[model samples]
Target: MLKNDQKVFVLLENNNPQVESLSKQLEIPLITQKQIDSHRDGFFLAWRDNKLALFDIKSPKKGMSVEFDARSMEQPSWPAPKTGTLAQAIGKKTKTVVDATAGWGQDSFHVFRMGYQIVSIERSKIMAALLGDGFERLGNQSWIQQLNLKSPKLIVGNAIEILQNLEYIPDCIYLDPMFPAKRKKSALAKKPLVVLKGIVGEDEDKKDLFACALQVAGKRVVVKSPNYAEPLGGKPDLSFAGKLVRYDVYFKT
Candidate 1:
């Protein structure tokens, strides 16, 4: 259930059956863009520029959408070469990964582009819908079609429960739970993360989720956390530090 302050509605400009169906399925109101004024402080879901996007009422002009393409402006190439901190954390030998906390799906998509089999799990209905739409778009990309590439499989449910019931054991279980900012700073947080926090709240049970991942992961469990925050599952077997985040890996003996 959504928080009182995080009310979300679906915006339909015309007789869009697909949007209408999505609104019904999500149990959110379907309204026109004009109607958005009434819910001036709420967030909205709409199709903008041929992609499903989430718009905050405060900044409707700057909506957030999932994109599988390379994020760096300098690197316009698709399927960026996987030789970074994330790849190091996931390990060179890891073939299958289960992203147990796939918020926004940026990490999962990155790993997928690296040719690793990925399964993404998202609990929020809104995030799941956005991810589903993004994956569908990824599947239709010319490069993806020509190479017969498949997008990461998405599973919508509580990760604590889903991790235990996975049909196949994955080589690595990755967790990137939301952690509170270390200190209040002058710079505003990223729009996508701010909007996501408002909608999904924080992951208070991340430790429990980490514990569960340890039990189910075939080889190792990787927990991504703010560099300043304490590790979720005690001391890690190895830790890889990035610019603002760290990946703590716990190997299964």
Candidate 2:
């Protein structure tokens, strides 16, 4: 794994101590955003519009940064929570879920919006840092804080190790290990996944991750897969199908 210092640096919007504090937390070089123009070969974390974001230095001024927004009403699937594929897989009985591969955290956030306590585990510090920023933003909202909605806990480590050592077992273990898109080309290329793949690459120990989830989940383990890929957990006890994806459910016997 490439160290954050080797691949990422932090750029402050101005001279803010809070931004600097965030930079230190990421453990990468800190510089003013103005300095980004001269250094455009690697990734840089920048503060913009009151949000923490990841920017590629090469086109720092041209494109958007990775931002996670966890507000329930803002998410596309929140309106009909019970109808979503992830909600179906989780069902009403699930009390807690550990999202073992929280790529961009969409599924984990969805689970949280549906009222299930969720924990997100991402081995990629790049993703974890971005996810942390997102959760922090959500925590500050008056409505959320007033209602006492807790942000999903983020653990920056391999899920296999974290799962094996959890203080308490989760009702469901969720896995969405990265799989290449089934179709070669699509109208809307998923830029987040593209940028993520550039940072984290593919999961090489997917089978082992599934095995670990099976061992730790109290009630069941669920794996999300593209329609074209084989089930990650071999033959599942049940499966929930969606438009472009499916969830393989393996109940604990």
Per-residue lDDT of candidate 1, residues 131-245 (tens digit) = 9988998887767777777878999989999989989999999999988877664154777887888888888888899989999999999999889899999999999998888
Provide the RMSD of all predictions against the true structure, rounded to 1 decimal: 2.4, 3.3
lDDT of 2 by residue, 88-154 (tens): 7877788988999987778877777777888999888767878887878766766566666777899
Point out where model 2 deviates above 4 Å.
1-5, 12-14, 18-24, 31-41, 62-71, 74-81, 183-188
**Lowest lDDT 10-mer window, candidate 2?**
70-79
C-alpha TM-scores of all predictions: 0.92, 0.84
Superposed Cα deviation of residue 218, candidate 2 (Å) = 0.7
Colliding pairs, model 1: none
User: What are the lDDT scores of the predictions, listed in order?
Assistant: 0.85, 0.76
